[model samples]
Target: MRDNGAIAVFGATGQQGGAVVDALLARRARVRALVRTPESDRAQALAARGVELAAVRIDDPASTVAALEAVDAFYFMTPEADNLEEVEEEVRVGAALVDAAAAARVPHVVFNSVFGADRFTGVPHHDSKHRIEEHLKKSGLRATMVRPAAFMENFATVMAPSLEDGTIVVRMPLPDDVPLKMVSIKDIGRVAAALLLGTADVPGGAVEVVGDEPTGPRIAAAFGAHAGLPSRYEALPLSVLRNDLDEAMFRQFAESSESPADLAAVKAVEPDVLDLAGWIRSTGWTAPADRARS
Candidate 1:
């Protein structure tokens, strides 16, 4: 462990938190993962990696504060809420965590927020995180917002392509040529780790992190090239999601080409940051043929 002290991270078993822990480990920082279920398999997995696990419940400030005691820094991110009701719950949970960090007197906090969260884009989930950002700001604790753009990993999940008639088709509720700002989950962790470790200089104590801006066709081509298959892009209607919150979010996505995250600026901090093609290759993302078989 480095002499700076242990860094405590909330949501440590999840994707964002897991990535943060990995980055901190790579930098030789001692990591304390605050989890609700210390007995969970995920928690055990982290513990196996030498991560110190502390049980915490967001509703119990005492538990959270105890988990944060003596940590050099705290890093956290809220779970996504798909409805207005869940959004309010997210705000409540986020505020509680922020309050706990303050009570513990952690010197610095790094919040993994979403890009455009500060803009009040009318997306319930994004706005919910912005509310947490507000709570963090008012808590009077030194804090930094490492706002990551859309996850490049989403292409492997929500935006994964479909195979039909021997061709791979990528679909989104977006125009084919409209670029979507993206950052790898790993990069998000790297940026947050830098802030928590005081290794990165971010103007205004916040940065919108993005590594690539790729349109649907470009996304399809990358997958196609990897698999040696033909590819195409399909623009789907927002109504297909059947969720008002998602529809509203996608509507804002239509304007994502104008995101504040500068690729050059992000790369300046994380030189090994991957673009779409690089992510595909590094992740070993294959075409739909392999996906379907899996």
Candidate 2:
């Protein structure tokens, strides 16, 4: 069993934070999940699982500081929004939490950052995390930033509807040979839990989390195989997506950055980290033939 300590988890209702809370609990760590609504069904579920609940305004750093007084460790994850301004606000709040943790003398901090954040300055969200990272480093806090690769859940997010209709539109402007580093959000939580529980440490002071690296067509094939649909990836220019802000950013990523993640290293830390195929099966997203017929 992992050592016991009170760990404050931000974004507890969301995917990443929820996974972290579950992982921490599995290792018998005391978890204090910060939620906007303690009455929320998800929050209630976490409480039922023996997770302590703390209400705090995630956008307010001062509030986080007050709530984190009882926690020995902190896991901070910025919530994503459709608006760029909201994202910027979250970044500021994340940095504040880091400073707050420092003041509180939290022993360890596990920050969920994006892969290529330190290297790619063009991606606004990625750069924001890097700025927070700089602040954490300057604070002299014992922190481990987990820079996760592109989420495999994203394929479902952008392509689910299109895949249901048969063709998976690949908006990424990358060649077939160029691999996209992808990891399951659950795997991200697993890695973070290991760090927080003292089960593992990033030798280089940071972890680039990746479960698998697959090309666009390969992702399409996996989805097709799981869904039992005759789906194919149709690589199109940014114009096809009508220059959507998110798609444009992804295009910039394809042009400027390379998705380099050490999957072997990640696997060594958490052997249960799911590969693409394993994730596909676990999610149970495969539509039955009868459902597809409709």
Candidate 3:
């Protein structure tokens, strides 16, 4: 069991924050989740699970400060929107939250940043997280910024329709040998909870989170195994992707395939972290018929 601490979880109703809250509860940590709607289904479920519900909008500084006043740590993640202005707004909100947490004298902050956030420039939403990380470091607060690689859950997003149609589309141009790291949301939560509950000695640290490093072919194989179809990854050119895809989405995917960072660092610390094969197996999906297509 991990030590209990009063941690304020932002975006608790969403994916990353929801995972964090679940992980915290599993370890018996005291969690205070900030939800905009206390009566919403997600919020009600969290309340039922013993998380303290604090009403606060991510953009409201006073509400954020009040929520952080009594918490020892914070788990921060902003929502992603379709527009650039919304992207900028997320950055502004993150900055505001950081300021409030610092003002409240919170000892630790855990930010869910994206892989290559420190260097990527084309995608505004993805890049905004890096700016927040910089602000947290300069604020003199003990911070652990986790830059997670592309999520395996992304397949569900892109291929959900294809799953219904029995087909899959490969949008971003990734070479057969280009390696990409994929992490599960569940593992992200587990690692994050461990970090929050552990000693707060390592400040100003940035950790890259990943479960598996797989190539396009490997990914196709995994998908095939899970979906029971002859799935194959077709390499689409960047020009074609740009014409058919959202600019921001295409840019984010394009840059991720080229990131050189190793994900073994996080697994080294958390040896029980789930791998891609284990993740697929856990989902209880059947393997495809033609493994050769992958």
Candidate 4:
């Protein structure tokens, strides 16, 4: 077990931070969550669970510094875009947080980055995370960076249209044989929380984390089994999908699917990490009836 100390978690209401908070709490670590609106239900629930809630806007340097006071470690995540200044806002918030971490002299920092952040620049949001990673490395802070692969939960959003109609649509253009790794948001939290609470001797390093590498057809098969339907996976050309989505964003997804990181290397270090099938079974998704009833 790791020593119990106060840790400040930014974006505590969101997926990544929420997972970290749960993990820390499970390990009996004192957690301080920074939120923009403390009265929000999510914030209230966190407080009820024994999390110390601090009201602060990530973009405000003073507020961030105040929240970071006396924190042993920090978890940083940024907001996503909805087609407007998404990338720029993420970069700004990230830079501000790092600056505050430095000023507060926080000893340990962990950041959630996207897959292919170091190489793929087709999308601004992913690239924004890369910039933040670079900044954190040069800031002279002991940091651990986790670059997660495409989230399994993304199917709920990206493939929702098809799910609603009892069909599956492949929006990004990629070869049928091209394989991409996917992970559950829950697993991301589990691994992150374990790292935060364990004295695993990881400092000043980055890990490419993935759960499973499955091709488009394989993913469709998984979803089909869960949904209890004969779903079809069709590879839509990027040019066709571009008519409805941002071409730049679509291009980024295309590139990432084609050039995924080595899962063997990721699993080698984190041997206890969950694979796709294991994640599905643990999350109760294999049986659609159970998932819906829950």
Candidate 5:
């Protein structure tokens, strides 16, 4: 079991933060979840599972500072934004939280940044996180950044494959051979928990949390094999997305293959991190036929 002091988490009700809380609890670490509504169902469930609840609003950093005061480490991620305007608001909120953490004198921090955020990809949300990263660097507080790769969960939603002409097809604004680094939500948590508890450290004080590096064809093949069906990947044009932010993100997906993830580095921290095939199997990701049956 990993040894960790008390931890306070912002965005605890969301995907990344919630995963961190789960990983911390699995390690028997004390967790305080900062939520805007203590009485919400999700917060109540977390509370029932032994997570301490602290009410906080991003507009009021004082509430964050108060919740953070007694914690040994703090984990936080900015809220997801839909467009450039919301992206600006994300920067503001992140800056405020960084200032709050400084004021509270939190010993350590773990920022849930995106993979390639350090690069000026010009994707609005990615740039937003990088701006926060810049603020954290200037804050003078010790911080470890866990940069998450493409969420494996996306396949269950927007990235889901379609059955056309009796063939399963996964289409994305990516070329067939360009590699994409992917990670399960659980591994993101495990990696962050390791950093927060001092059980693991990255040489640069930042690590891109990644597991599998699969090309588009490989991704489709993995799903196909898992579902016992033949599948193919169709490379779609960026214009098909019709959203500037998403188009930029997919463009980066192609560009980033030049510098792929170091899988060994992540495995050193969390040995059981799932590969793409394993993740597909673990999710029991269904083909179109199976979903129709359900």
Candidate 6:
């Protein structure tokens, strides 16, 4: 934001981080992307875009400090992993990154958190980030927290497979009248960049990002309209998602997917936020012809 020096970005190879890196580059900001493998294709691609790739392990304090050297600011987001050990690694690495940033005396830090991380939602993932936010607040670093709602990308990863049979099965019955808060990953990047660049009114304040709140039928209608298939929604109880998601997350989906973000404020920051239908049409998502093959 200050345009003083280069900014270091963690997880630059992943979705959220990549979007931030791209946005920063668009603003002509000097960016250094932290990654484990500098030779990886994604990392190399970032390097090709004029980003300085710093090959460093986040858990190692010394490596992290080196990565932050001469960095004027930082952008951080915790990485999610699959198993218990990997999950512990995420916390460890995230804490180490925070400590390293503090020790380096970086002037500004923008932290990516979940929309409902302000308090305990009984969801482990959501609550875990709240803890991280607390640590960041006390780390003596000037930080801005950017909390984003449920990602629209989940349509492809979590729901599209079920659509192969021309029927999408939802774990929780999302009534047509109910609303669910959803945001595009690109919009998340835009908001974060705005905060870091000091373009928004509340630069250091907590900002919740959400694009739209649509019901199950509305979502199915959007997908069906684009895919040209007779797709329908079949909502079950929250119990069906237990095996795949944490129990806490299941409760949120079954009860309320509507986020507590201020839509007007978020829209003010990123005016062109995409809605469900626009996002679906842009991705060219289609119905699968055969469920077995899909």
Model 2 lDDT tens row, 1-294: 224558899888899998898888888889999888999999999999999998887566677778788577889898773557866886787877887798778888889998866664566667778888888889998889898887889866754525335544344555666677779999999899989877888787788888888777887777767766665565655565533446646665575346456767887789888888889899887543342345
What is the C-alpha lDDT profile of model 1 across 1-294, one tens digit per residue?
Answer: 235689999888999999999999999889999999999999999999999999988877899999998889999999878788999998998899999999989889888888888768888999998989988999999889988888998889888887767788899988887888888999999988888888886778788888888888998888888878888999887878968998987788777675445777677678888888898899987666544454
Pick the winner on lDDT between candidates 2 and 6: 2
lDDT of each: 0.87, 0.77, 0.74, 0.73, 0.88, 0.76
Q: By lDDT, highest first, what's the ranking?
A: 5, 1, 2, 6, 3, 4
Q: Each model's TM-score, in the order given?
A: 0.95, 0.87, 0.85, 0.84, 0.95, 0.88
Error of 6 at 290 (Å): 5.1
Could you tell me the TM-score of candidate 4?
Answer: 0.84
Question: For candidate 4, lDDT tens digit of each residue in 48-105?
Answer: 9999998987757899899988888888887875444767778889989999999999
Separately for all candidates shown, the number of backbone clashes (residues 3 or more apart, or on different chains) is: 0, 0, 2, 0, 0, 0
- Candidate 2 residue 6 Cα shift, in angstroms, is 0.9
Judge candidate 2 against the unseen true structure and give its global Cα lDDT, from 0 to 1.
0.77
**Model 1 CA lDDT for position 27:** 92
Judge candidate 5 at residue 213 and give its lDDT: 87
Off by over 4 Å in 2: 1-3, 58-62, 161-175, 227-230, 240-245, 255-259, 288-294
Ranking by TM-score: 5, 1, 6, 2, 3, 4
In model 3, the runs with Cα more than 4 Å from the true position are: 1-4, 160-172, 199-204, 226-230, 239-261, 287-294
Candidate 5 structure quality by residue, lDDT tens digits, 134-226: 899999999988899999989888888876665678898888889888999989999999998878989888898899989889888888788
Top candidate on lDDT is: 5
Which candidate, 2 or 4, has the higher lDDT? 2
Candidate 5 stretches greater than 4 Å from native: 1-5, 290-294
Give the least accurate 10-residue stretch of model 5, judged by summed lDDT.
285-294
Clashing pairs in 2: none
